[model samples]
Target: MHLTDHDRAMRDGAEGDAIAAAMDLLIRYGEGLGAEVLCDVRNVAGTSTQPTPAKTIIAKEHGWDKAFSVINLDSDADIAIPPMRVPTCQLQQGFNDEVLSISPYRSELVELQDGAESFASEKGINILATCTPYQVGNLPTRGEHVAWMESSAVIYANSVLGARTNCEGTASTGSAGLTGRIPCWGNHREETRRGTHLIESDVRVESFLDWGMLGYFAGDVVGEQRPVLSGQLARPTLTDLKHLGAAMATSGGVEMFHLPGVTPEARTIEEAFGDTVPATTVHYTAADRAHVYETLNDQGSSTDVDFVLLGCPHASVEQMAEIARLLDGRKLHPDTRLWVMAPRALRDVADRNGVTAAIRAAGGQVLTDSCPAMSRTAPEGTRVFATDSAKQAHYLPAILDIEAWFGTTRDCIEAALTGRWKGELR
Candidate 1:
């Protein structure tokens, strides 16, 4: 890989030892990916403050700075860390203290995360502790290059917002945060962004549930490759698209997709395919949708739901309002617990607007920063769970060894109220 004079200077320790290590990692990462050049990036989403066993052990052996140097920067050198060079934010991690009484997660982990947060904040990393950074205030401009870590967020950035990013990991995003540079490969290049598979929907994908089912089907059919959707679609809001992307990322390793007329990069089907023709054309019919629905619910056997989770990629304000409306006058069943995961910023919006109060009145808690899947904890003895998020339904069963039922938000709310899973595909 070729480095500019500035890159060379950074690698030669002109900026500092920490930055030099960061530059060295970027160079090696770029070259390892067969990338010839590195492009400048201003926006980055990472998980440097998340408390893990590895991070804890390293921090115990060698202070937080060395922990960051080894875990984040991929360097063993002892050097002082500096403020982020570019704008960066932390992603979803362990549960916060507010839900300790309800969740089975440990309190010590939360304390460790609090200390990690302090260290990260002092290093100029914004604690936008949600999977969806675009939801808060970190919306990247169209066609902007960014290094984001979350799979759902990566899909959203690449497809919905037209920003360029691969499904980045901890170390690469750490390097990007300090250097403001990432490899100009994968989704960053225009040629590689073209659609690989074409999916035509025969069933009208209008509702949030329908969109999520379509995304799950698309991901399974296309697998790590990009898909272009053509027919039988409705105008999707941010929340609907958010669910779609998150579901796709969960079922498969889909980082980017194109809705042709809807997404920014493609104005037509031809543009979505670029100069090359699509490799395959897949038809998504009503039967396929039903199959996806069944697949998402295959883990469940009991009709009695012990828990209901509303968000996987974090709930948007619109979703919060809808959830609030559904549970306005209803209280949860005595045996069931309901929690709506959201970004802290949007949780504040719900709090001020009485949305949170409405849900609370219904005995549902709207928590932020983490979910059951990330925290690896659900309500104690949660044998069977129900959720509106296809992503959560697809993941939590395998992660927690619990059963899940996937359905509409209304169906989930009904389960939360009645403690029974009466959800069937409508």
Candidate 2:
């Protein structure tokens, strides 16, 4: 790996044990990737200090700092790591702390989450527990280099915002918090950002679900290759893009995608591919989306909806506003549980705007800092689930081993109120 003078100094332990450790970790990681050099990263997102199955239970039982060093830094050495040098944030925690008393979730996990938050706060990581960090105060502008871990956020940063990131993970990004550097490779390279496949869709995308359907189909068609989309696509909102990126990451290993005249990086088709035509092209129709819906929805036509989950990448304040508007005068069915998770920052704004209040008053909850995708703490006997997100509907059935259905926001809200599912796209 290529190291500058200061990097070499740090490597030689000139910067103390903590920085040396961080530098050593980064060098090994860069070497593993056959990277020739390292680049400066201004921003970073990484794993919370929350306990995971792979983390040592002893460190968790000991204290927060030890647990953080063990889980995040990949080093058990008792070195006092410095505060985060670059702007750093956290991905969402495992479960919603708001439902501690209401749900049957283990108390230990909540306590661990609290410990993790405390640890992160002390380390100068802006504990913005969210998958969509750009929605909050951690927005990275075009051409900026960031070390983000969340799959959806990474793709959005590279594809939509024109930022550079290579999908850094928990252990790898931990070093970014310390050194503000990462291996210069993969999506961080300008040549690799060009599209490899061309996808043309004739069907118009209407809502977030439709966008997600298109993304799911696109992911299946383009596997790990970057695709340039040129089609009769409708103008989509931020929510639509978020859902599409999330579903794309879930259904396939798509690190980035380009839509000419849509995403910042792709102002034109020629620009999207760097003036080189894609090696392959795939065409999609409305019938292809129908087939994906049939494959993703596992409820098998059963209407009895027992659980309704709205947020997978965490709901935005705008989404909460829409949800509050829908449940203004209506109450959820007594037998059904509706959970809508959002970032803590957005949740606070939602609370101040009376958006969370409206949902709570209508028997639905606006949760914060957690999503059910990572943790399945559903109430007793929730066999049938319905969600507005195609991402959740695609994975929840396999993760929870329950019947799951996908529908629009209105359809999901209606199902929550009536305990019956009516699949509607919009």
**For candidate 1, which ten residues in a row score worst on lDDT?**
58-67
Please give, for residues 86-192, the per-residue lDDT of candidate 2 as tens digits.
88888877664668765777777777777777778888888887888888877788888889998889888888888999888787788888888899999888888
Full-model lDDT for every candidate: 0.92, 0.82
Number of clashes recorded per candidate? 0, 0
How well does candidate 1 match the true structure in TM-score terms?
Answer: 0.98
RMSD of each: 1.0, 1.6
What is candidate 1's lDDT per residue for 1-426, written digit by digit as tens? 988999999999999999999999998999999999999999999998888898888887888888899889998888899999999999998888998899778998998899889989999899999998889988998899999999999999999899999998899999899999999999999999999999999999999999999999999988999999878999998988998898888788999999977779898999888897889999999899999999999999999999999987899988999999998788999999999999999999989999999999999999999988888988999999999888889889989999999999999999999999999999
Best by lDDT: 1
Off by over 4 Å in 2: 54-56, 299-301, 424-426
Residue 73 of model 2: what lDDT?
A: 68
